[model samples]
Target: MKVKTGTLNRVRIIGGDWRSRTLNFPNQAGLRPTPDRVRETLFNWLGQTLYGKTCLDLFAGSGALGFEALSRGAKQLVMVEQNRPVLDALKKNSEMLKAQNVEMNHADGVQFISRETRQYDVIFLDPPFRQEYLPKLLPLLPERLTPEGVVYVESEGAIDPGEGWEVWRCSRAGQVHFHLLKRTHA
Candidate 1:
């Protein structure tokens, strides 16, 4: 459901230095932020601390996952958002939090991934649920991750972890099927 323009909606940081802090974001269609429970669970699976880890939040909507990582001690975070208004809101939230570790990019997630050369310790993939981006994006992830890196994916339905990848953790919350994935060794 799309949040009406001009209506204020907030998402709270679940843990870390900014625990319990709330960030207000403009609601746009297809801009669903990962739910608090899911974030908490995902982080728990990730061990609750991201100190010195580099992260990438592809298709960053409300900047929720990226900001959460930063709050939990990620050394660097890159958030890529395509929507102008949503991107503006993300930038505002980053500035409000005085976030120095975040790098906001106004770009398409697919395009960014196709050209990105640096590897990330953790990558968050939460594209618009209606798009069939997973089939295309998943194939590109392994090369983007550091050897021990992980990819957190949120989808509307079950996802098949294609070649060279394995599901490390999986759970469901309502209609969301979230998974933590890792690359399999040859």
Candidate 2:
């Protein structure tokens, strides 16, 4: 939780190459890193090792999901965060981990996804709660996902991903509702 060195907060890598490794970030509003328990469950649903998978982390606050994917063998990862300070913190964490496959973007996550043409094996979506970001963004995700690709969504409440998306797996931890989804049609 709180790593009392200055104003930094820390979170540990749940599993993978960096298991037990701690990452630090500033106290920024709306920046909740995925909890260790939730991440462990999500990764278990997706598999322990990503191995050569390309990934994307939208609204990548604190770089938790993306960095975890990297630790598990994700070959390439692109993380988009709107907040410059938060993005800088992500870069700092990336450097601390000596990660080479990460590409950080200081841009609006929604706009980046809407304009993105590349497809990925996995995508992490944990936008700020109560913003109704899912409705505007989910429609844009199917196209960005490679065939068989899965999307991991974390939200304040259960979400209806509409038609064509199948709920592969889902679970809840207190106020956090997470789901692993895949395209059901096409």
Top candidate (lDDT): 1
Backbone clashes, each candidate: 0, 0
Q: Model 1 clash pairs? A: none
Candidate 1's TM-score reads 0.97
lDDT tens digits by residue: candidate 2, 1-186? 553333788898888888888888888777899998899999899889999999999899988899999999999999999988788889999999999989999899889997899999999999999999999998899999998899999999988899889988999998899999999975
**Top candidate by TM-score:** 1
lDDT of 1 by residue, 58-120 (tens): 998888899999999999999999999888888989998899878889999999999999999
Cα RMSD for predicted model 2: 2.6
TM-score to true structure, per model:
0.97, 0.95
The local lDDT score (0 to 100) that residue 148 gets in candidate 1 is 100
Off by over 4 Å in 1: 1-3
